[model samples]
Target: MSSTKDIDALIDLMAKLPGLGPRSARRAVLHLIRKRSLLLIPLADTLQAVAETARECLNCGNVGTTDICDICTSEKRANGELCVVEDVADLWAMERSGVFKGRYHVLGGTLSALDAVGPQELRIPRLLDRVPSEGITEVILALNATIDGQTTAHYIADNLEGQVRLTSLAQGVPIGGELDYLDDGTITAAMRARKSF
Candidate 1:
């Protein structure tokens, strides 16, 4: 048996992560090996802990170590508004901006016709239920600028019309751009300038 077999397997697994290729994974693994006591050991412990505990919030679909995420459970965030986003990453991006005071609803993904994804596939039904249960006065659609994202937003708007005020992030969100790529200032500006959908 080769002594480097386990290390090679680790590198292979790391390469599968987003934004990391084989070369980068190899370099990272080597660096981690050099800093084993400081970085690698702690990182391994954290990864194991997270792997065992990470779960999606039952209320809003945001990922956390609990049944409900911190944002969903916060009384301060229940400000009569709910921001709808396509993914957990988008929700995290919005939170990082520290601008939106209200709560959030993560849709998981856009409505994809080709992939046969529909409202039922996402958290649309749960979002609709939350509107009435939570007394949400406004819903800010912060979905991506992609075609599927807009389609999903429009569908939600149609379902929610007359029930509450519906709005979307302003035009500064470039076509095909995901919320995760935008700067915090741009996100804040788009949210502040949101218009009726």
Candidate 2:
């Protein structure tokens, strides 16, 4: 029977977001309440808009406001090279470095036997479909370095074998590292030193 039940609910919802815990969510909610006009209102509006309009890109599995993401529709990005990642966060990390010039294919997640996630569960079939249609010459597997990530990468490489040149980011990356967690410089170096797998 807290007087601030609505605010507490807001904190609970925010805490569910990745990287934000209960303490952080409470602080954030308090800050938003204090700055309602400057931050809270705007954030609420934007969240509402995104909730209504955000969707997966039909072509590349990217999260966007349209059926096809901007990268997939951009002619300049169609360079015969496709970088495959486990999530949209990894794709955004790669884009942050401004190193990759080609298009991207987001696998949504890695194959996990324990989780029972297979190629069909993810966007693998769509990836295979895109390769031939888009005239892709190379596919760079930019997945994380975990066991599940490696397993997924091997699967994709096997499926795409003989169709295009397959490569992976170089090994300056630590074991179990996720692309989204790597610094921009590290991502740049790894991408630059990518080799055939």
Candidate 3:
């Protein structure tokens, strides 16, 4: 039996993760093996714990360890503003900037005609429900600038025309860009300069 078989399998698995190719995965696996006690074991333990406890927030679709995420329950975040994002990664990006104090609504994904995705496939219904129930006075569309993202934003805007104030992030977020790839400064600028939809 090959002694390197398990290591090769580990590299293969890691390579499947985003941004990690075979070469990068091999290097990472080697580093982890070298730091087994300090990094590898702890990482494995955390991954297991997260895998078992991770769940989508019942009210906002944010990923967390409980049914309701901390942001949803925080009275401090009850600022009558709701930020809608296409994914949890976008939510995290907004949070990293610390510019938006309002609650978030993750749509899971954008509307895609090619992929047969629509409002029903996302969390649009829940978003509409939250607007009235949570007393949201404003909604900030923080979705990506991709065609699908723009399409999804328009749909949400049309459905919520007369309910509340609607706004979208301004400059800095390039066309066809994603929130996850933007820097904190760009996110802050875009948020601070948001405009009406």
Candidate 4:
């Protein structure tokens, strides 16, 4: 007997998404309903399709509709370098930068003692296996600038020390950052990694 019951339920469900709160979700649902023919129906169909097919790539842990992602199967990406990221979102970020030409390896998460997450829980073992098999020459750690991220990076570095060259993204001031706004840790890293002009 409630005409707005299904709409309210839809708003409730949309509000559960990462960044959307109840207000945003209600606005979004209203927009979708207004554009039902052009957006809502197609969006529903696409969501259903993705829900049925989306899966993690077996080799690199990238999310895709196939067992392996397109990047893993691309011949042009066979440059002997592998960028290690903490999640699929990081992998996508690196790709968006368009600077890293080599492939990527996604560790499901960082190694956390409190969470009981270890190398095995991530893609560390798979990464080690891929080094020799895939002829990897260098590994670039592109993890976050967090304590757990550094710990995971160090663990990977220790394991792959002599087997391949190891590198990490520089942790310093952003390109447009002013020194006064930067933290002490960022300033120190920028000083330590200072290069010739």
Best by lDDT: 4
For TM-score, candidate 3 versus 4, the one ahead is 4
Residue pairs with colliding backbones in model 1 are none
Span of ten consecutive residues with least summed lDDT in model 1: 1-10
- For candidate 2, write residues 62-130 as lDDT tens digits: 899999999999999999999999999999999999999999999999999999999999999999999
Off by over 4 Å in 4: 1-5
**Compared with the true structure, what per-residue lDDT tens digits does model 1 show for residues 136-164?**
99999999877899899999999999999
1 against 4, candidate with superior lDDT: 4
The lDDT for every candidate, in the order shown, is 0.93, 0.93, 0.93, 0.95
Clashes of each: 0, 0, 0, 0
Count of clashes in candidate 2: 0
Angstrom error at residue 72, model 3: 0.3
What are the clashing pairs of model 4? none
List pairs with backbone clashes in candidate 2.
none
State the local distance difference test value for candidate 4: 0.95
- Which runs of model 2 end up more than 4 angstroms from their true locations? 173-197
In terms of lDDT, the poorest run of 10 residues in model 4 is: 1-10
lDDT of 4 by residue, 1-197 (tens): 24388998999999999999999998899899999999999999999999999999999999999999999999999899999999999999899889999999999999999999989999999999999999999999999989999999999999999999999997777999999999999999999988898
Write the number of the candidate with greater TM-score, choosing between 2 and 4.
4
The all-Cα superposition gives candidate 3 an RMSD in Å to the true structure of: 6.1
